[model samples]
Target: MSVKLLVTTVLLLLPYVHTFSVEKRVSKLLSWSKSENEAPTILGWCEERRLQDATELQVTVSCGDSEPLEVSIPIPTDENTLARTLWPSSLAAAILLRLPASEQLVKDRHILELGCGLGLAGIVTSSSAKSCCLTDHDEEIIQLLKNQNIPNIDVSYLEWRDEDRPNDIPPSDLVIGADIAYYFYLLRPLIDTTKAMLRPDNSAFMVVGQANRESQWDLYHNVRDGCYNQLTDEREAPWNGETRMLLYQLQMFKWQVDDDIALENQELDGTIPIAVMIHTSPGLENFAFTTFDHIATKNDKEGIMMSF
Candidate 1:
């Protein structure tokens, strides 16, 4: 078969092969949404020379009543190792889809996704967030991100291990990652990076996921000991039928809390009910839900923030 025909065939068959993988569907949804826009975005090595199985990916994100945003990303045709591939692991897909699916959590928020392998999470959230940045330590990954013509997102290189942080990257309201806690040594750098990029105010939240590995559990303790407060913890089965994956929503804070505000405000009378929070935005008069609950008490100028 001709190289063009072979590459086309592989692209077509890829959906069927990875149908159960949510990331594949997210990519397809991105591609489809892009095609629906003013112009269809191009991806992959479109040079005269085509590599076999050099695939392109798409990611789609939607907010309430808004047109879904789509991004077309190219996958490197050279790398064949397990470490480098465009395919999204189960944890990655979960983290990408976790917040974007909720209009209240993502809409109008400035988002950043670190160690974005294929940038699936950032791309998926770009449509909903006011702004988004997708970054990775790998030079090749940054090149791949540059190739994707995603609207309303800044694609850049951000190394977590760098002692001097890059000045170009802006602070974000939310930070996200997937399967980032692969090794024990990466724990500190990832935590530091998360802290550096966040807004430092109580409003910012970080959502990350990891495969159910015993070693990765150390990350939980490290985060708690650090400046973050753990919010929601949930588990799900992977697409490939592997062990359950853990998803965590952690709240970032600049100031240390002397007391457990969440524990104390659990039953405050003046607090608004949960029904109001699902529709309200933070920093507004209406109640908004964070990793914790908020309660207004007498003589308190600001409502107390509580973590779930």
Candidate 2:
């Protein structure tokens, strides 16, 4: 088979294959439960233990010659409480503090933090921001943040897959996240949630993490292909021996086109011009070309001009 034909066939079959795989997994779980004659139970339920033994640790953060601010964070002792860790949160906080003061990226802006496990970064930034919202999907984490009673900061539950959560969140001037893109399946929902929570223009999202997984690279490409434009050059810092930390600043893509030219072209050809911009790296030109060609082919009959 030709390469194009094979690619098209796979694309068409992907949805059905994904659905079948999900159904098969569910069936296996049901069969196992029936064989055992009881409901399946997850091991290491640590909610009670975490609440009982959680300790508070003070983290001091300083920005641009400002007096250091100390934040007390609850340390979850349970092995399953990965969300409550402080490594990437510290890294993300450092990056946010390192942002140039001339840009005023966080100062006086409405900042929102996604997956704000221990609320480290948000709490640190709340001092400069007009208001800050710290969000996490875990109920226990939300409760912990609320207990802190930090002024000018709000704590809320936010799961990216939950569409209603975005409606409750106000449009933010800036969105920040740390170590949220560790899983491949989370990229789309996280990006969608960030876009929903941000203003249509002049808003930015900043995310930081250790570049130890492929998902982080996928996140970069996903943002590039989506409605966001990179605001600053990619920033990296040395973390441990071999692992490097990376930060990305992305703003919503805004069109800067001449209305008169667009109108003239539309009047001349009786077709609207649709601009498709692709931001790509050295090795991704073929992917961009394939995307442009697909859109052009799909809209061939429509009264639209596809400009890449």
TM-score of each: 0.52, 0.54
lDDT of 1 by residue, 1-308 (tens): 99999999999999876543322221111111111253322111100111235467443443324454455666765575332543223223423344323445468888877778777667766766788888887777678678766788788888788878877777776676655666767766876677677664423343343223333444554543332323324332211111111222221122212234342233322211111101111342232222222232222212223221
- Work out candidate 1's RMSD over C-alphas: 18.2
Per-candidate RMSD vs. true structure? 18.2, 25.4
The lDDT of model 2 is: 0.51
**lDDT, each prediction:** 0.47, 0.51
The global Cα lDDT (0 to 1) of model 1 is 0.47
State the lDDT at 56 in candidate 1: 70
Q: Estimate, for each residue in 58-176, the C-alpha lDDT of model 2 and write its tens digit.
A: 55543335455566777655558766666433333443443344135567878888888887768777877889999988888788778878998998888898767745566887687
